[model samples]
Target: MHIQSCGTAIDVNFKDVGSDRDELLQATKKILQKQLVGQSYRLIILQHILPDTVTFLRMARNAGINVAKVFAKPNSIHKPSLETLVDEGFAVSCLDYGEMEGTEVLDKAILQEHALAVQYQEQLVCVDVGGYFCEPLRRLSPKKLPNFKGVVEVTTFGHNRYSAKVKYLAHPVISLAKSPLKNAEALIVGESATLATDLILRENGYLFVGSKVGVLGFGAIGHSTAKALRSKGHLVTVFDTDPIKRVAAKLEGFGVSSSKQDLLGNCDFVFSATATRAVEVADLKHFQNGLVLVSVGSKANEFDIDGLVDAAETAAIDSDGISCLTYAGGTKLKVLRMGKAVNFHVQSCPDEVMDLVFAETVACMATLSTDLPKSVLSELSDESRKEIAAKWLQRGTYERN
Candidate 1:
């Protein structure tokens, strides 16, 4: 598909592996260019990343689209870019809560769509990540908003899980899966994740240095978790189904376990870093007593939470705010924030780190609005990496800009 945007034309051949991530980003830009024509479309952005969203809003201005309004968290509305976008006639409003907490904004955005359906018809498009934005929009009664057009759920989570759910919602819901630059952000954000985990462990009175720690999965999160635990003087062991990853971990000066059973059999604390079901009921059977299982991923599907509940003789939160599941065999498993992403659940990530993460997402979104080939997943081109890095390095401090 050939898309022409702002006098620049690019051929989008998703099937062609030769097309790098830059071209894919160009494809996204082209799509947005086409969609935002004649100041007719109302592009409602639930703004998270200030700088990147401003960058996209400028593109919207150049495209002549009506930059209706941007909804951001309450205290996150003071950025210079945000002021620039607002000064340029874009309505920038504040949503209640912090960057990660935008549920109220989702509600208000959907309510705005009701009037927009009657007034604007098909010219309305909402860009949201968490299912919160689209789910309610999808549920809006057709009787009220008969002209409601569609929604685009950007893949904020591991995969495009929300896309399938909204497919049956009777609207053209676009699910853009993992962004190309996700791993790059993952590597950088690992610092905050490590900090959150360390703080949580310490708050619960768990000794870090002397503990036998096992890191499950060898992806970005897994590798970072292992490195962080090792740095804290813990005896860290790595386990993964992939032999190459296990070998890589071994080369990093860490012990490699033959299987999940082996890791479970030896560790005092184990971190589930993979999105998959790395620790199943079968594997839990081999878990050492009084094991601490801190999952640094989402609460859903990362581990077998239901299975853990089923096998446990008692499930309760301890006095120190840690979740504990005691099994019939006198073995107990402790989880952080009930298996949610420890960093996110704790909200321990500093504002600047989240800004960087959100900025990366914005850059990816600028490149994702178009149709991308299903084969290629996450990536960061040299130019794109430099651009993101330049932004990161430019901001020397974590002040609310």
Candidate 2:
């Protein structure tokens, strides 16, 4: 066992199992028993998709914290694989796709500590730059957002969870920059950097050089996605806003699309990373009827494909319903109906996002020193450095709380 500080969060890295988890849990229980003072907290998040069952609930339980109500979104990028805490008698809410569209009052339940379901809105808003549904909440008219706090997601589809409650938030650069990959290769762009990296470097018996690939939106994820495509010797084209970004993309040997429609009839695979209205619903018609588009940004609104891939068409009510899609390319274009649109958001899990989220949450839960243990920050001393490392790690995989 070891203990150290990596800034505001505590990292208790232990090699022991079974007994170790129990011991740590016991230790955590004792700590929380005193900290609670007496009130519970609402731990609202999409967990359980990671390899290790995310232990927020366990941590909360150990802390003697009552989980007000768990937001078990059915349309989550990754639903609980292990037994959800909700399933085990915890107050879990299986959110409907329609409800998840921002149609319901997520905040009402999230903030109220144990409030039961109430009247929901016609639409809910979802922001997943790394999930299957880019436009997760495109169908409803929600009660106007009162302020930014309730509008934005505290945690994105990715594990980059930073709380708005903190005014002077510490930047986690070093943690994000570390190369988690065993053997690092060229970096890939796209919010779902994991899948993009895997697809580019892995020798799965596929051609790369001269392969036509289109990456829509030249944002952070877009640039990364394009770079990965190029690393494998494939020809890549980039389209996005921000002229400077476009210029930078051009410098990288990518063909920048002046307009969303510019992508038509020029590529085989189109990866949309920009959530702007241009590349979203309106751009669906611009594809050459057989274009394959994958989104790792925002909700899956890159295409106006309601009937094409809605829950009704995919029959997501049954098990594994979330991985469904409606192909827009039709028959000839349909021959290439691939798996879940190369969605890393849905494919990644609680384990993947928790390390970052836990670190952030702990940083908020405790402090950089007094509350945070030294063990967690041992990997990097500075929070900014850690974030940089995390950025590097984005292209690969890592494990931890």
RMSD of each: 12.1, 12.1
Task: Please report, as a residue range, the 10-residue window in candidate 2 with the lowest summed lDDT.
Answer: 1-10
Give all candidates' CA lDDT scores. 0.56, 0.39
Give the C-alpha miss distance for residue 277 in model 2, angstroms: 4.9
User: Candidate 1, residues 101-145: lDDT per residue as tens digits?
Assistant: 434555556567547745765355566544445455555664664
True lDDT of residue 5, candidate 1: 13
TM-scores for all candidates: the values are: 0.60, 0.55
For residues 173-234, write the lDDT of model 2, one tens digit per residue. 11222223201211222434435334432434333346677877775556667876677677
lDDT of 1: 0.56
Error of 2 at 17 (Å): 13
**Residue 61 displacement in candidate 1 (angstroms):** 12
